[model samples]
Target: MSFPDFAKVIAALPSDDAEWGPRNTAPEGVPAILNNAPYAPYSKGDKLGRMADWTTDSSKDGRDGQRGGRQAYNRNFRDQQVYGAGASSLFSLQHAEDEATFSVVDNQRTSTKTRGGFGRGGGTVFRGGRGGRGGQVTARGGRGGAQGGRGGRGGRDDRYGGGRGGRGGRRFGWRDFDKPQRLRDASVNIKPDWKLLEEIDFSRLSKLNLETDEGEDVESYGSLYYYDKQYDKITPKGPEKRLQISERAYYNPTTSEDPVIQQLAERDEATIFATDQILSMLMCAPRSVNPWDILILRQGNKVFLDKREGAGFEFVSVNENAIDPPMDPTDGNKESINAPQALSLEATFINLNFAHQVVSESEERKFSFENENPFYNPSEETEPLASKGYKYRRFDLSVSEEEPVHIIVRTEVDAVIKSPVGKGDQFMTIKALNEFDDKAQGAGGAPNWRDKLVSQKGAVIATEMKNNSCKLARWATQAILAKADLMKIGFVSRANPKDAGKHVILGVSGYKPREFANQMNLNLANGWGIVRTIVDMCRNMSDGKYVLVKDPNKTVLRLYEVPFNTFDEDLEAREPVAEEDEE
Candidate 1:
């Protein structure tokens, strides 16, 4: 009664037809299989967990179920081959309608459900949201959100702004993950009492457009030396000419600090004042990605657009709007030499010297303006004055018969070139584009200047137009502001990619300012509209100092009401501390 004899039991069972094993029956013409019935190949190592498993159907548990089934079976029997797996797609179910046509409706309201906090109904604190890269937090909900029904007790709201399409989780834009998150500090410190009057994004600024007539010259100062045609003849061919550093005096004063603009403001020549540099920055702001601040000082009816002592606007940016812009100097990165800051400095130096070196310094060849240089002092300045001319121009920005707005901008001319068509001497604005390393990150896929500047010049220029859109736009704007007949762009690149110290000139290309603006799709009307909008904002406000700051991470401009003594106090505070440190 314990057990049956193994040999007797095996002998008694039918040897030809075993019930638990492969059948021995064969079809008439079948070569592979012994059984006439359909057969599935089995491996010795296959995990035969169940004779009939039912949970693997995708319809039963959704797509997750199919994934789980694959995971479970694959993990246990990875080496085991399944028969008829190739034709398994034939058994899969087909949908009656396209999946793309279907949509999901999320009707979740703003979560006003309160949390534990010190408030009438507990308060909800929002730590971060879209465009909050710098760890900015907002406290909402609780008693305050009760009326809005978008936060607080019994209200359905998200931590971020809640609406039908509230972004509740991490928000990403096109290819946002390719670059590291950046948090930039403001140009000027923000005091607790400063009030934010306006916050405008690039979208709004880009949409603004207003046509204005050519500005009339109010006054002119300084002198412009004739541009030497010899430099233009040089090509980026066999032997490259090294870019020489010149020791010449060049004046680049800010708007509010300029005595000429101050005098114009005092005389009430215009309701608004700005320098070409600052004006160009505001005009080309929609294309910029770097952080910059423009100081708006209002006295009675006049508003002046100015810059800080050493603003980022002073230096020309390189590949700022590229998908992967030049990174900051990190600890161990060797390519940090091509960092945005370093490139800007090198480009700035190249421009300063290129303008001076290209122009003929002869007094006889130079053309004098209506007045002498306002900022230049012959005795105080040891270096010879670089060729430059400034013109104070005024444009009308009146909306209707009642409101007449005028803005005076001090525009600069680098030099003058003889008209190619023989229509007298033509005014010109000179700027140089420097190449750091074409192979470097954030090079914006630019070609090697030495190789391409001579043959594939159009390709080089097109790439530059894409990579340095903001910088080129600013230059063109400045040229137009000055009413320059020609805009000269010089191609300059480092002698060696690894060495940022030395550079060489490739060649020069010239284009009319108006024509160049059109090529870059730079809408002067939009720029004028931006100026008018900002002027209107200041004109409506009480007379005070205001600062317009560009958000680094996002395309936004925020205007803050600053105390009259904010920057002055900061300078004063630093002076004493600096003196003490010196002691």
Candidate 2:
């Protein structure tokens, strides 16, 4: 049904007046407020009707459900005519009367206040107290002995003359403290053309594919249904499917004829042997790996693995340079040239399964070298080469739990060439190991190794600031000064001449005045006076005659000493020379 027709049915329902109550049970046709209206003056004690008992058979035997019984009146039908006419008319009349009376009083009071006139009596003004008057007091003219003096011209009229004139009251200007005038300008009216605004077509705008003159392509519009269907259809036929198939075939070949198939078979056998070797080595001797020795090679370098006469092997190499000595006889001996010089190296070692194939076939063949002389002897050999240093010097490797490799390198100064390969220049002795051996424990002893693995996988060295090198230096300096009983003031020295003598200079035993000025560029930029100032401050405080001035606002303490007049000339007379030469 239409909405209006449904609403009309709702409006026609019978109201509360149709029920039998005091108002409805009033005498039907009686006039003159008579007929002893029985329902009038209604009270709770009045008997209306007998209560029904649901436990009796009248309700349960289906007799109550028949026609012309109580069920007839209980039908879902309402008589609107019996109650609608009087109830609506009486409410409307009373509401109209209340509105009419309220409007008259409200209008009258609004008119009175808006006119700015007070009712009947007017305002009044009152005058205040008068001005003060001055009066003279005179004692009785003399005594009887001085009667003549008492009558002397009525005491020459010594009474005060009159009161001073009252000052006029202040009068204020009417314009003072007046509110600014308000201009009567019209408000701006901006009427929008609502018809020009387009109605939003959400369905068309949100469509995944829009049909233009171009051909069909992948739709980029954000439609969940379209994306889901497109992904479902494309995924299985994509590149990932090919990758999975290839990986499975490479790991588990179907036939031994395939090269990959043979490799897989060999790899499985090799893995078993390698595991046994690692276990045997670990059990052979209780050994510890040094973390510092496990160095990460820098970019553009190579590692060479050298085989010893026995099964024990070591890795080393000269990276990005010639291993043999230079041809020039005057260039110095080989040991002198390679005297424990710091060189960055890079290297990588991977299992055959993970290693990339070498492009050159000849190089690959060279890499596959092997010796099978199991009963080989070494005593029947030519002259043995003198032991100059470690056969293998540097090693770089990455070790994991699944494939652990032990690495150890001698960092001590004597580990390099022990004998002088050169006459004048003795071969520098690179130490093999030092006393701090316990501090060289590797990753197994590291407390944060697990955290480092999760958060910073390949970061071997902690950041510079994390090492606290500078902080430790400062702390050590302060400790030395404290132990020496010297005043410790935490002040940053300035590089300017004007800031000299403002901060204390410590550890100035071998500090040259010229070097300080040159390093700071104070001679050409600021002046040589900064050097003089620093020297004077240092000399005066050398005898421990200085006062500590504490800053009230901060924790810093400033040490001050008396200035010396001859300090400037003394620094100026010094000659310019290299600081290292002076040392």
Candidate 3:
């Protein structure tokens, strides 16, 4: 018997158990790494054919030991033959010239069974069976054959068929896991420092002065002599015109209280002097020397006083034999500077009546004083020699005055500098006198020269000791606290904490469905996983979660937790209601 035909044997073999085998031991076709091959012009189709040959060789080699020689040969031959024939047939079907004839014949056949002149099975596949005796061919039947199977019915031009169903979509779920809790968002602290305050200069102040002079009108006396020297001399010249002297001080009132003054009094640094009381003492005190001066100090600077004694005092005498002097004499001996001898007279107390007259009659009068003997209780009983017609009285000298002074006082205390950051020079100045006028017509129009002197002295002492011991403690404390606060807030390099959200997960091979589910559950437990995984992934990657679901046409990813109450309502409406069973 002849060996079974190879094509028939291969076709009859079960496809499930068949295997191609044993490729050539030597390299089958072209070596994967080609060497020294001639360059040949190639068409797109030729390149494709070469690629197919290479794939076939590779596949054969890969299955070498697993299949028999006959099986391999059959498989290769059948694949080439069947695939090639099928491809040619499909191409012919698409481009067949007989299409018009088929279409004409198909259209010509019609049935009156349907309103459209076509039966419901018009597009259905038909099968033919073997003819009966006489070898006549069988006619095509409408019913499908057992093995031929039914062909899909052609669809109406306008009607689209339902698409395949999609996979069940993924949803967010929660699972329990331990996690750390977060506390405060942030905290910071600040401390105080005095560097800026120290930089201010406090000693400088504007100085003001007023002065006046009195001289005899020699020309007028000469004119009186020309009219009648004897008569002018004899006639009591309108009570020798006296030179009236007065002094006043003025200042603006403000609400700012000197902190230094307050501290000084609190610490018992000095005594307070009331305005009225100081005025009374200054007015009553007798002037033993020419140009007696007084000074007031605020903090460490000098302040001008309201009034003081003048450069000299004069007494007028009436002389009947005195000859009047000539006006504008131009003689070398005419100019004379004969120093008057100091007078030593009996004790002369202030004329109370005269003082009262001065206060009541003067329009620009300032402080007034009663002429009671200011030195009534002198330290010694024996009176000293009189000088310049005034008794010498010993005055009590004490820095602290019992009464509060109208003048403001300040002290050197530690002040916290607010703006600049580093150590620097700082200063402050205090106003000494409340007021000084240039046109003042009084005993000593100038501010009390002694006040300026006292200020200079005090300022010198205070500036020498720049350190304010009292402020040091508080300043140090504040600075330390501020540094600590800065450290706590990570202002310092070493104190800062590691930056958050820097860690990332890695090493995953493929998308694991179960692992994704677990991660979703974990996220839910942590209040971050309520969103659907596919939807979340899509949101992270592109736009919609529908794109990620297996079937975009059917599956949907919804924001279930959004308007959670609405979701609950929908769930409640869809749920089945319970009914009582009949007994």
Candidate 4:
């Protein structure tokens, strides 16, 4: 064909077009979207490598499996003894006995439990790794091994190398191979590559004058965190970013006053008002875990005194330390009221827990105690506060801001160490059993015994802590002062509860102090010897609430009438403590 004729014929053949173009594609066409992935060069057709290895259904053998896959292949390996001759690799017909493991739980060792699988617990090494089941798997088959024997591996046992549960062995598996600490918690000892900064010596890097301006000790004008104000820039933290740790100290030094003089000053700068009247004084005060130190500066005249009797009697506790320092006489600034000779009392709350471990295995040590906690108890039920795991119990020892009082608590722990057997630790009331020891040292040949066990022993006592009995002692001062006649405030404990009834108040003491001196624990010199009369009326109150109020000095009643009960209000059991305001 000539060139011109061939071109003309090609043009004429294109006129019968059926809308075929490169833009659109037919449905379900794989190459519709051009894939940029690389492709191997084309080759010849397929062919068998080795006669198709006709035994295609051959089960997975250790040779064909990935790393650590030999365990499964070997686990089912037949027992050679079953065969009469040399049939070594034959599968065994005996049951897979060690398929699951048993976990120890409870201090009493009363229950039985078994777990299986390594899908979760770091290959049976970490306590949390076994069974993939956390606190929710509480089957009662852990203590008594789920089999015929006392500790035999049976029901729910983790066989095939899951070391936790009952008798679980460490099996080779592709899932756990090459993974460091397959079932254990390893320390995150990260060493960062400092690069050029490696030459920096961090131990003695530099000195920084970090100026802190947070809180000051009320009694001592020193800073909790020291800071130097001589720095270049100063930034006051906004109210939103600031945090208040505790109640503002009872005393504060003015900005103009010298810190040294504030320390030397013997009296407080502020005067608490309206406490002169016995009822008002007691109600308006902040509650304290420490019993208030009450003292009478001068005895009121028995004849000339206002004839108010019973709850209406006018009374006041003089706190000489609450007196403010005398004002400088030069500025013509005369003081409004002279400092009262007496003031409300102060006290120190005591904690029984000491530096040494006094309690071990739910009982006090054979020897003596380190620190004396008068409120210590041998039982397991903690009183005055309620708790659950993850969060500790906090109660408002104070009634409210309106009636500010001392802040107190029952215990300090996130979870309760519920004693499994009998009366548990008296301080731990919550029922949370997360105690375990997958790494228990003494458990010889036992598969991760500690990790899967739940213990009843309380928190390891290594610090000083006040016992729950301290609750009764908290209100000793107030109870003796305001509630003396009506509330029958005394150290009378009706020790009959289990065999008798439920209204047993406190099991601490039967020695109630009605006189002002013993109520505030004042020295003998500060008390009135003429009113030297304290009848041990509550001595026989061992089994009843009817406390006898014997007349001190055998003095007859001025107005003869039986004292009847009136008020039944409770100011305790307030809500949680509110964070103090930044202002």
Most lDDT-accurate candidate: 1
Q: Per-residue CA lDDT of candidate 3, range 1-583, in tens? A: 1244434433443455343321223132334332342222323232131122211221223322233322233644543422122122222223334333453335442322222111132221122211111112212332211111221221111011111111111111111123122121111111122111111111110011111111111110000000111211211112232212222111211112223234434554333311211222222121111112122222222121212112011111111011111111122212121111111010001111111112222224221122212223246434421100111111112213573212221111111111235543211110011111111111011212223223343332122112111111122222221111110000000011121111111100111222322422211111111111111222233221111011111111111111112223544654554223321
The runs of at least 3 residues in candidate 2 whose Cα sits more than 4 Å from the true structure, single-residue gaps closed, are 1-469, 472-535, 540-544, 547-557, 560-583
lDDT of each: 0.75, 0.20, 0.19, 0.21
Model 4 Cα lDDT, one tens digit per residue, 78-154: 32112111111133233355333556566652322544333222212222222332322323223212222222232
- Judged by lDDT against the true structure, how good is candidate 4? 0.21
Worst 10 residues of 3 by lDDT: 487-496
Q: Which candidate is the best by TM-score?
A: 1
TM-scores for all candidates: the values are: 0.70, 0.12, 0.12, 0.14
The digit string of per-residue lDDT tens for model 2 on 1-583 reads 4677546535544467645333432233323353333332323343333333222232222322223323223334223112122122222212223332353334321111121111112111011111111112222221111111111112110111111121211111223255233221111111232111112122321222211121111111100000011112222122321100011001111121223213423433211111111111111111111001110111112111111111121111111111121112223322222211211110111111111111111322221103211122346534321111111111112223474322221111110111234532111111000011001111111112222323442231122112222221222222221121111111111122132112111110111223322332221111112112222333333332222222222322233332222123444555444454688
Query: Which candidate, 1 or 3, has the higher TM-score?
Result: 1
Alpha carbon deviation, residue 540, candidate 1 (Å):
0.7
Ranking by lDDT: 1, 4, 2, 3
Minimum summed lDDT over a 10-residue window in model 1 is located at: 163-172
Name model 1 segments beyond 4 Å from true.
1-179, 573-583
